[model samples]
Target: MKEVKVEKLLINYKTLEEFKRFKEYGHQELSMLEDLQSNIVENDSESPFYGVYYGGSLIARMSLYKVDKKYDQYFEPQHDYLELWKLEVLPHYRGKGYGKSLVDYAKGYNLPIKTNPRVNSHGFWERMKFQKATYEMERDFGQNPLIWLPEGISERNTQ
Candidate 1:
């Protein structure tokens, strides 16, 4: 397989149109569109959405958000971390390493990462070396979170 390039998606109608092809397209994207129409966010401004394109069409995407230390509950030493969500590769693009490419891109940050894997995707996250976060009723709130820790970082002990 050729190298996959994960890119930061620009917030624009074209990008939005491309996103509709994704199954995960819903509130997150609709809100972005509304924000664009209302001038809440500029068309080409930086966005949390990132994607992989194939033949000039978006084939995979994920959103990465930096959560402040004060809100960090998954990593030891309480530092800033990335919250990864909405990772999806179009049906035809699955198994081509596009999903792994997007994940590998997130790991490039070298920060502890957290994500709630979609049902049946636990195996994939496990393959990426992410471990299940210890459940804490208040923090977890029924979401089964998986986490990846970078060098020198450890999972926070929740008790």
Candidate 2:
């Protein structure tokens, strides 16, 4: 298997245009476009989006956000954690390890990770050793969250 490099996507027209190939393009992307149009965001600025490119085209992508411990509700130690979202590999790229590469990149931070996996993706998260987080009606609302714990960390017992 080839090594995949997950790169921080730049906030620019080219990156945004590349994003249109992704299935999850929606409000978040549109907001970025709006920001660009209004000069609210500078070209080549840092973005939360990261992705793997194959032959110079984005084939997989995910967004990772670091949540402050003050708002953390998923870890036993109440420490800062990464909230991962929109992990998607293009249909042609599925089963090729690009998705795993992105997840592994996030895990490299060694911080606990929380993600609301898309429907039917539970198996993939499970394979990555993430476990279902105890659901809190008030904290979780309608989303089912899964979490990955690094060494010396554990999921908060919401029970």
Candidate 3:
């Protein structure tokens, strides 16, 4: 496998088409298409979505959204953190480290990161050193959240 490069994606027809192949395709893709066509977002605007292409085809992808410090619920001192989502590697590309590479790119930011991973991905997140936050009935309702904190930061008080 060749080294993969993670790029911030643009909302274009091609990108939209490749997105259809992923199981997570739904509101997010629709929203981007609407935003792009209405000029609410420029065609090549910087998006939180990132992906790796194999031979001119996008095969794996993820999205990372930075949360404002004021709204942060999972880190001490209320610093900005990344919320990672929609991490998927095509079936044919599984086990080749594409998913791991996308995750590693998110880690490169060196910020506290959180993800409500797809149910089947627990082992992958564990291997990536992510740990489940201490359960909070109110805050974590209906979701199992996993998080990674860079050295200087800390997990928030879930109470």
Candidate 4:
């Protein structure tokens, strides 16, 4: 299997246009567009998005944000970690390992990662070795989060 290069995406008109092809396009993307249009952020400003491009087209993408340890409520150590979101591969590009490649790229950071799986994506997250976090009413209200921990890290005792 050939490796797919996951590059950090920049916030630009071209990049935003490419994002329209993704199924997860929503308010976050629209907010970026608004920021660009208003010049509140520069055209090529760095974004939290990472993606795989094939033949010059974005085929897979995800957003990763680092959360400070102080705000951490998911992992045992209470250290800084990554919160991954918006992982998607274009419909035509599914099952080609593009999604896995994007996920592997995030795992390369070696930080514990958390993501709220979309409905029906449980199998994928399980395949990725993520476990459903024990739900806490106040902390996880309206969300079901799955988490991946690097060696020696474990989920905090949510019981």
Taking all chains together, each candidate's TM-score versus the true structure is 0.87, 0.87, 0.84, 0.86
lDDT for 53 (candidate 1) = 91
| Predicted candidate 4 versus true structure: per-residue lDDT over 1-159, tens digit per residue | 687899988777777778666635443532333433443255567678788999999878787899998988878878788989878877788889898998899999999999987778889889999988884437677788888999988888867
Off by over 4 Å in 3: 24-41, 135-139
Q: Which stretches of candidate 2 lie over 4 Å from their true place?
A: 24-40, 135-139
Report the C-alpha lDDT of model 3 over 59-132, residue by residue, as the tens digit: 88887899888887678888898989778777788899998899899999898888887767899999999999
In candidate 1, the residue pairs with backbone N, CA or C atoms under 3 Å apart (3 or more residues apart, or in different chains) clash, namely none
What does the lDDT come to for candidate 4?
A: 0.79
Off by over 4 Å in 1: 24-40, 135-139
Give the distance in Å from residue 131's predicted Cα in candidate 1 to where it truly belongs. 0.8
